[model samples]
Target: MFDTIDFQALRRIGLSQALVAQMFNLQTEPADRLMRVTEVQRDRLRLHDGEAEHVAQVWPTLRIALQMQGESLVVGDWVAARRDDSLGDVCWAAARVPPVNHLVRRDSSGLRQVLVSNVDTALLVMGCGQDFNLRRLDRYLALVRLAGVAPVVVLSKADLLMDGGASRAEAVRRHLSGQVDVVALNGQEAASAQALSPWLAEGQTLVLLGSSGAGKSTLTNTLTGLAAQATGGVRGGDEHGRHTTTTRSMHRCASGACIIDTPGLRGLQVDADEAQLDAVFDDISSLAPMCRFRDCHHEDEPGCAVRSRVPAGRLLSYHKLQREAQRHEMTVLDRQRQAAEWKARGRFAKAVSRAKRG
Candidate 1:
């Protein structure tokens, strides 16, 4: 099915070398062909075979090479590969390309985990019913902004808001900046699915994120025109979605774009950098430069530009986003300090071991 994939699109998504080799069916001659990786499992990878698809296991040599380079591969990466005589098949592989962009998060252990590499856009999906939360959207925006990808807010399950009252879209617009495009539609409707086609262009990679039962799987099924994923209903009392998607899976849309569906995030730990926080609170950042004092907190500062606009309501939203951004920045700093201390202790232990050996 991949015989006609757009090579340019593959390059744009940043496929790693080893996976790229398998994608082009060049595992037998790694030096000759390039392939892009569509998905990855613990020990195996699903690669595009130029026109079809194939699976390859990570060879020990490639694994060691990745470790040596301190580069971990993720989905949406391109790679190179070659056959291994010892494995009795074209099993050995290597990552030849590095990612142009990657979505990374700090795991509980303080290690950086790449969620997906080379994504073009992030679709922040939120259900219109009781699942909509402005603070949660702020968190998603901060996370995606750090990755340097475009963000689109998708208000799913719009059919639920058909009562003719204040629309869910209106509620979302109140919290979002006018610069962000907001799409409200029912995933079950074909017309609604078509609205998202422009972003699903061939070779592009988009990720769907929201709370459980926020209609991510439903939207995925609509876009793919098949029931490739399972869906569960929301809880009767709370209107919360069940954990229907158990794993992260990448699917190729008929339009040639790649879509990654992740399980609903129950808790989003703040693990982004100060730059990301600044991006999410751009209005505040802009005002900070105008403050009379460089260290203006905006609370009672004499020449606070941010505080000046708050009474007129122009900066109320900005102030709220600024507070959330500050909280996330502090959290990230705390995590980094903890990680540094752990590394220092490990080094100290190794030094003591060397002294004993001598």
Candidate 2:
């Protein structure tokens, strides 16, 4: 039945020929249905099979297997499932179809949370007003760059800018130094959405990233040509807003590209390697090779090319992200030591409890 589905329809849903081939390879049973996860919930998933949408959940055994593999399903992930008539329109998600690539971030616990899978571009949306911050943009660029996805910076609410966002956009461009494409647009306008049309070509996938009231939902609505997501205004003083979009969701844009809009990220920790951070700061990274000392800290050091050429604030951001990355890279010995310490504490508490009981 899936074989009979038109490729064009599947393309609209972000299924490419390569992904279709991968789906076939992942399916073991003839009756298994191939579906793309559009929305993820606490215990259930919303899947679309390019024909119909269904509420789905992973089987018990499959859940255990996925846990053993340290993998969990997220939006934009292709999966193999089967229809179960007893569940009254629910399907059993059997397994995940491996993504070509995926974007992930670390939670406060340092556990990996896969945001979206198989996206080609990441639109790092920020407001032209009080929401614009180069440091936050750099962090986003590093995350996407690490995932091997192209990163684009889109400054929304240009209409609110005093000089039509031209000066602010130029400043952002100078900060980035042409490292990534930057676009300034009004999220509610169709013509403004057209500025991003190149990356939204058919079969491509894009994800939106920003803080609250950054116009992510408005842009998604404009691109999809549907008022699917609710938009809200920001506080005049701080430009902050209540969390309007609470979950990660995928939509098919009018250009046939799929877009995933996620909840506002209040705190972003880049789940990346030091090398990835360096890649985002290529100016500083390039000068590192010219430093006299191989392991130069670039602070009051002789022949420090990086220190001499790179701006202090930019270098500080690089160092900050580097420290964060190293902190998250828990070694085997470190994890074992942590576990042993917890166990020792637990045993000591148990002994104290036994003495108290006696």
Candidate 3:
């Protein structure tokens, strides 16, 4: 099904050689239709064929298979579906082509939530006022790094910034140690399109991550040259935006790039092993090796190299995120146990629903 796709069509939808190869290896049925997931609903999904959008549901077989693996289809995923024109063009997804990378986080329950997949770059949007928080941005950057994607910190609402967001931009640069790109712009204007053109080029897929009132949806409108996502107004005093965008959706830009806009996140939990956390906090990780104790937690321990050079606040944040990672760490049996528990809960819900109806 993958090889038969036209080269131009694949590029038009942001498909790379690696993803094409992965699809081919899946060896899906020839009758299956290849489409990309644009939105995921309760019992159905909206997909695109590089042209039009169609609503589809996960086939029963595929649903059970995904349940067993503790996974679910999400927006921005390329999937193979069976389309039935006789049923008024209904579609059923039966297979998914694994994404090159996925932006994910752990919910409060410690279960993995895949936000979006097959992404090349992540746009971390933050406002300069009440919506801004350096600690929150740290979690976002860590999530992107864990997903193995490049990140660009976008400071929205530059016009409203007291100093045109210059000081805030510089602060972010210093916080990240100038390792990632930073852009300050008025997201509601056309010039934001030019400021972010490098990441919005053809075939580059980007996801916008930020809190409400940070102008994610507005930026989507500007970049796509259309009202792709609904814009919301902020509260008069606090500047918190209403939850205008309730779900994630994909929008196509004139530049041939795809933009996935997500709803605001109140809190983001970075779930990973200590080694993974170390990668995100490379500054602390690099110095840990020089500590007197190999298992140093960068605390009161003597000769703690990480404690000496790194800022006290950063070291503390590392320990906090590391603790969350450890709480959810698992082996093979742990995964099986979690999957089984989920299935049991699903069955219990079904039973209760049936009883209530009876």
- TM-score (C-alpha) between model 2 and the true structure: 0.87
TM-score of each: 0.75, 0.87, 0.87
Question: Model 1, range 255-292, lDDT digits (tens) per residue?
Answer: 66778888877556545555656666676677788999
Best by lDDT: 3
Quote the lDDT for 251 in model 3. 91
lDDT of 2 by residue, 1-358 (tens): 3434556666778887677667665644667767889999999999987767889988787789878877788899988788789988888998777788888888877778778898889999999988888888878887788889999889898888778788878887777666788899988899865799989998788999998889999999999999888888777687654468999999888888889999987678888887777776787888898999999877778999987666676677788988888767869798788789999999999999999999
What lDDT is obtained when candidate 3 is compared to the true structure? 0.85
For model 2 the local lDDT of residue 314 reads: 67
Residue 239 in model 2: lDDT = 65
Query: Which portions of model 3 show Cα errors greater than 4 Å?
Result: 330-358
Instruction: Find the 10 residues in a row with the least total lDDT in model 3.
Output: 1-10
lDDT of 3 by residue, 96-214 (tens): 89888898888877788889999999999998778777778888989999999899999998887778889889988777678789999988889998889898888788999998768
| Candidate 2 residue pairs that clash | none
Task: At residue 326, give the lDDT of candidate 1.
Answer: 59
Clashes of each: 21, 0, 0
lDDT to native, each model: 0.69, 0.83, 0.85
